[model samples]
Target: MKQVLHFINGKFLESTSGKFYDNYNPATGKVISKIALGSEEDVDKAVEAASEAMNGEWGNIKINDRIALLYALADEIDSRFDEFLEAETLDTGKPYTIARHIDIPRGAANFKVFADTMKSVADEAYQMDTPDGGIAMNYSRRYPKGVITVITPWNLPFLLMTWKVGPALACGNTVVVKAAESTPTTTALLGEVMNKVGIPKGVFNVVHGFGKDIGDRLTSHPKVDAVTFTGSTPTGKRIMQSSALDLKHLSLELGGKNPAIIFADCDMKKAINETVRSVFANSGQVCLGTERVYVERPIFDKFVNKLKKAGENIKLGIQHDESSDMGPLISKDHQEKVLSYYKLAKDLGANVVLGGGSPKMENGLENGYWIDPTIWTGLSEDSAIVKEEIFGPCCHIAPFDTEEEAIKLANDTEYGLAATVFSENLSKAHRVAGQIDAGIVWVNSWFLRDLRTPFGGMKKSGIGREGGHHSLEFYTELKNICIKM
Candidate 1:
């Protein structure tokens, strides 16, 4: 098996603790690699390297130089696109088509867009006239926060890491990234690209391990100036509490139990297709997956039937197979968790309109963690299945008679990450979108993202916005300077 080690100071190093953990291929249910289980000592070394790079050569490099480096990294990533596609598929159990079409391309786009966008950032200035005839001027300058800890989850490991890392590095911050142990392959490959592109030593570091072992140390370390994490709400809360000791800056993009409201006047075919995509894409492991769907009463039955047909047609096979529409969940534990929800929903009297159990597979995939796409109806609004984030290929749908009730049902959950409204009535689309309490709302589309837009959640979904200027701002601090003349 291949051994994956930490990347510190532009070099790969084994953990000081001399311990390792297994990394499994989700599709085959077999260990493919061994990753170093980093300890607090490993985190300290990475942080120290990051701090030195931030204060030394990297800090002194011109903005144009930084932009050049970013473009070079992007080019390197594009050159190795096929390798990244395979690594992401093997690690995350996503279909090869999805990885090739979405994940890898988007990772490269993040770097390219952020490199171009950072060129447009300008400081603010103001002129004030003094009462005593003296002129005064105030101006703001943005500066890096020095040594940030970027912790990314497994589902979209490379994509989310670049989403945070691109802006942070573009803004001149050094980063110590802790990739989730389950999906560290592509991220390790990223370290190689960074080194080959000649990004200054210690400017980027990757440490792989379980969260409890090294994550707590990295987040709470004194040398680390800030943290950007994408994970579960519970984990985000713990990181928030731990980082509060030093009052380190934090940007968290956490969990969601999102909703999709389908109106009677919608394009039924479009609504059904997008709704199915929202729920079953990436096996419904997305944080923005629309777990609770509310359909307008007049078309509710028809919509359910269409959605059931769509779910039944989704092809589940090995990740590398070109014929597969969707692949397995990340691991056996996660598959069991998702399957438990299906049982609970059935026991609570929710009608399983489509799949409600795992499907058996032949060949070597018999032991793989696979769950059939499932759709449930006849469930109450407040049921556990409706209210919780299943994070799987399952959704519970119900009917609403009025636009007001649709909005009510959509915003009923504590999560406010993302929501969608399908309506041909432009007025209703805007009006309902305004009423929903989600950070991101799609009037007639799903997952259509622009890199320049503000992205994050409200309520328990997240703590701060990311992408575009928001991300740049998060990685830097503003200082106001005043002069008298």
Candidate 2:
């Protein structure tokens, strides 16, 4: 079996403890690899290496040289595109086409985008007259914020991991990443990319294991200067509490029970197409995926019918099959969790308009973590299915009488990560987008992202923004200098 080992100090190392976690192929329900379960000892080693690099060769590297390395790293990742695509597809069970087109390219782009962004940044400078009528010059410069601990989720593993790593490295901070337990292959593979591109030893590191085992050790470690995590809200809260002792810098992009509001005047074809993608893309594992949909009452029946038909038509086949529209959940445990919610929705009297159970698979795929794309209606706002983040290929639809009601329904949850407004009326779209309490409100589209814009959640969805210059803010510390002239 493939052994997923730690990448520390530019080398792959087994855990000090000989313990291993079985890495499964979600599509086949087979043990594909063994992941080293990192312990506190491993954490300490990674941290020490990261700290040493920050205080040694990497810290003193010139900004121009560092940016060039980042660009080169992006190039190297592109060069090894097929290798990355395979590892990501093997780990994530996402479609090969999805990984080829979206994940791998975006992963490479993260490095390039951040490198270009870091190159273009201009610091602040000011001239002031002193009380004694002398002139003073005040200027600011940014420095790396020491070592960062990056904890990534399994969904979109490669893309999200690089999303943080790109900026962290671009800002010249060393990072110790804790890859999600079920998906460690791509992370292990990244160590090769870093070394091949000539990134300094200890500048990039990866540790594999369950969050409970090594999460606190990494997050609460005295040497770690910051924690950037992408996961659920409760986990984010625990990380916040743990990091509070040191008051470490935190950038958390947590869970979302995101919503989609469809107006009667929306382009029906466009809205249905986009909403289906929003709800079922990546098996609905996207943090921004919509779990609650509100359609204007006049068109509710037609919308539900079309959506049901679309859900029915989604192809759930083997991961390698290019024709497959969807793939399995990340693991059996996650599959069970999503299944429980499906049962609860029915028990709570939800109208199950579509699938609510697993689809049958044959030819060595019988035990795979398969779940049918599901749809529901006639559930109250207080229903668990309506209130919580399922993080699966399912959504509950409801009819709204007015624009005010639609907005209210969209904002009803505690999550403020993302929401979508589908309307032909530009004025109404703008008006509703403004009132929705999400960090990102998409009007007439879904999953369209610009790397230059700020990305994070509001309220409980996330703590800080990251993207473009906002990422620079988190990855570096600013120091101001003043001189009298």
Candidate 3:
């Protein structure tokens, strides 16, 4: 079995605690690797290294030099594209095609996009009259926020990790990354690329462990200046409390119980196709993935039937299988959690329109952590299945008679991460999308992202935006200086 260790100060080191956690492949229900479980001591070492690098060589490097290193890092990651693809697939059990086209490519693209954004970003300058009858000029200067502790989730581990790491590095802030325990392989592999690209030692570090063990230590560390986390709302709350002690700069992208509202005037085929992808893409592990769908009453029945057919067609297979459309959940524990929700939906009098149980597997995949892509209806709006973030390949669809009801149903939850409106009526699309409480609202499409746009949630979904200049704002501190002529 492979043993994955921590990458600290440009070297791979074993945990001082001598404890290890089994890294399982969801497709086979087998242990693929043993990851070192880090302790507070490990976090301290990584933080110390990051602080040293931030105040030393990395801090002194010019913006142009930093941009050059970022580009080189992006190129190196692109060069090893296949390696990253395989690692991401093996770690997450997502389809090879999905990992190849979306995860790996976007992960590398984040670096170049942030590098260019850093190059083009400008600060403010103001000219004012001085009280001494002389002219005064005020200009803004941005500096790195010091050691950034990044906590990433397991679903889109590579892409999301780089989303924060790219900007943190481009803005000249050193980072200590705590990748999710279940998907640490690709994150560990990136250490090799960091070294190969000649990024200075201690500028980037990775520590492996559960959130409770060392996560609290890293977030609460005195030397750590900021924390950017993408995970569950509960975890985000805990980190927020930890950050309150030092008032560290914190950016959290939390959970979402997103909705997709399908209007009667929508392009039927397009609405059905894109909504299906939105609900089950990456087995519905995406933070922006839609779970609660509200269809206009005239087309509700037809929409449910078409969505059911699409859910039935989803293929469940292991990594390297080109024929698979989707794969298993992240782990057995997650499979159990999702399955419990299915049972709850049934118990809550849900009308199961499609799969409600696990699918049969063969060729040594019988023990895999698999669940059929599920669809449900007839559940109340306030039901647990409809209100909570299950993060599974499932959705509970309901019908609404009016545009006002559609908006009400969509925004009825505490989470305001993302939503989709399918309407051919441009007026309704604009009007309904404007009323939805999500930070990012999509019309007639799902999961189409432009890196330059501001991205975050409106409510419990997240705090603070990232992407383009928004990310630069989070990673750096802007200061205004006034000088008299």
Candidate 4:
């Protein structure tokens, strides 16, 4: 089994606490590795290292050199793409296909995009003529917020970490990343890539372990300048409170119960495929997955039937099984958490139109934390199953009589992370999308993302954005300079 250690100051270090957490493979419920569980003391050491780098060569490196480092890192990731794909699948229990096609490639893309963006970063300036015929000038310069704490979630572990790290490093800020305890292998691999690319020591660090053990200390440390986290809403709240103690800059991408609204005038076949892809692609573990699907009453019955068929066809297999469409949840505990929602839906009289239980597999795979893709109907908008984030391969379907009702249903949940509107009518699609409260809205499609666009959530889903210019802004602090001539 692999033994994972903390990555501090460009070296793998043993935990000072001499404590470790067993990392499991959700596919087989087997212990694959033991990750070093860090403590407050470890966090202090990391912060101290990062502080030194921030005040030294890394903080004062030429912008061209920083951009070149980012480019080199991206190239390294691309060259080792297959290795990353395998490790990501092993660590997260996602299908090998997804890791290859989506996660790993996007992670590399993040670095490339940010590196290119750095060359175009320019300061803003304004000049005014004074009454004495002299020129007065005001200019704004962006500087890195040193020593940022990047805490990423288990789902899309490497991809999400790169989403923050790419921008943070490009902006010249040093980072101490806390990879999720459930999946740390890919992140450990990233540490290796960082070293290979010759990123300065302490400029990038990775600490493995649970959030409770070290997350609080990382966010609350006096020297930490900012915290960028992607995880549960409850944890986001905690980070918010703790970071507020020192008034640290915070960028959080939290939980969501996203909705998919299917209009009757839509292309039925595409809608069915995209809707299923939305919820079952990552076994519905995505924060932007459409957990609550609202269909126009005219086509509701047909849509639900199609969704049920798609769910039934989803193949649940082990991570390396290329034939599989989906894989297990991250852990047995998460599997149970998702299963409880099925019971709740049943108790609320929601019709289990499709799968509502775990699947029994052959070839020694029965012990995995696997759940069959499930579909439900006959549930009210306010039902617990509809309003809450199941974060599994399950979805609740309901019919809406009018456009206004569809809009209302889409915006009903506390989360406003992402929503999808599928309709053949362009006017209606635009109309409904505009009215939706989500930060990202898809029209006639799902998961079509542009790296240059702003990505974030609204309401309780999250605070701040993390993509393109928004990311650059979040990782930096602005200083204004004024001169009279």
Lowest lDDT sum, 10 consecutive residues, model 2, at 89-98
Give the Cα error of residue 414 in candidate 1, in Å.
0.7
Candidate 3 TM-score over all chains jointly: 0.99
Give the total clashing residue pairs for model 1.
Answer: 0
Candidate 1, superposed: residue stretches over 4 Å from native: none
Please give the lDDT score for candidate 3. Answer: 0.93
Alpha-carbon lDDT, every model: 0.91, 0.94, 0.93, 0.89
Compose the digit string of candidate 1's lDDT tens values, residues 299-402.
98999999999898999998878989999999989999999999999899989999999999889988888998999999887789988888999898889999
Error of 3 at 10 (Å): 0.9
What's model 2's TM-score? 0.99
Between prediction 2 and prediction 4, the one with superior TM-score is 2
Tell me each candidate's TM-score: 0.99, 0.99, 0.99, 0.98
Cα deviation of 78, candidate 2, in Å: 1.3
TM-score of 4: 0.98
Query: Residue 279, candidate 2: how far off, in angstroms?
Result: 0.2
Error of 1 at 69 (Å): 0.1
Order of quality (lDDT): 2, 3, 1, 4
Candidate 1 structure, TM-score to reference: 0.99
Residue 99 accuracy (lDDT) in model 4: 87
How many angstroms is residue 358 displaced in model 2 relative to the true structure, after the best TM-score fit? 0.6
Clashing pairs in 4: none
